[model samples]
Target: MSNTVFCKKFQKDMEALDRAPLPGAKGQEILQTVSKQAWQEWQLLQTMMINEKQLNLMLPESRKYVMEQMEKFLNNEPTDKVTGYVSPDDIVEL
Candidate 1:
């Protein structure tokens, strides 16, 4: 697919997420490999954005919003204690 089509699909996904009115936890699946395999995942993402030239397409506010959400999801501690056949409170939505 074209880059424009891909970006449009991504934008639609973000819009859908924004419309949802629930709190969410970070995506362990997305971060597990990408973050552990590379120490500077965030920095590398920025570098990749620069290389792809998509950074220019993103608004400053949008970039900042992404960073804020990403950091909160990745760095914050989970609040619930789950047992077998049960899930943590923080992961309830998922």
Candidate 2:
């Protein structure tokens, strides 16, 4: 069965994530409050950030930065977009 929650990010009631995405209280909070759609969106943004920043996930700082961004994103705060990235539609598909 699916669970529903008042998703703080989307500002409406929606289906919640099946489980915590991380290992602590914050993760539990997200599982209870964030929707699957919002989490997926964050994942895409996180990927963009990793690429734009050339973050080495093996390093602690990179992981910390990612977690910070995730928190902000889930809280409905604006996140930094990847700078100078051209949208795929702008690229000539040759």
Candidate 3:
């Protein structure tokens, strides 16, 4: 199969899996898949940075920093989601 076709199918499968409310073993599978995709994207970015000489030349340093921060967020480090700017109670015991 062609790389483009394979990637598209994989992406669709991943999106479906991520959206499902799977718990325990099922949830772990989704997390693992997402993490693997994130790692793959990071590797792709490093490749583009090295190969696309003119691409980086067009973007500012601040833009590059923002992209780096975004990559960190995708890798699951602390972000707004975990920082707890606001909390909503989903369940209550009366």
For every candidate, C-alpha RMSD to the true structure in Å? 16.9, 2.9, 14.4
Q: What is candidate 2's lDDT per residue for 21-84, written digit by digit as tens?
A: 9889978888888999999989988999999899999999999999989988989787777886
Model 2: ten consecutive residues of lowest lDDT: 76-85
The regions of model 2 sitting more than 4 angstroms off are: 84-94
Per-model CA lDDT versus the true structure: 0.35, 0.89, 0.43
lDDT string for model 3 (1-91, tens) is 2111112214433322233223687445445454445545544554544354334535687457545644454545542232222234654
Q: Model 2 compared with the native: what TM-score?
A: 0.83
Q: Which residue pairs of candidate 1 clash? A: none
lDDT of 1: 0.35
What does candidate 1's lDDT look like per residue over 1-92, in tens digits?
Answer: 21111112122211111121223443433322223322233444445544454345268875674455445433442312213323245465
Ranking by TM-score: 2, 3, 1
Q: Estimate each model's TM-score.
A: 0.24, 0.83, 0.26
> By descending lDDT, how would the candidates be arranged?
2, 3, 1
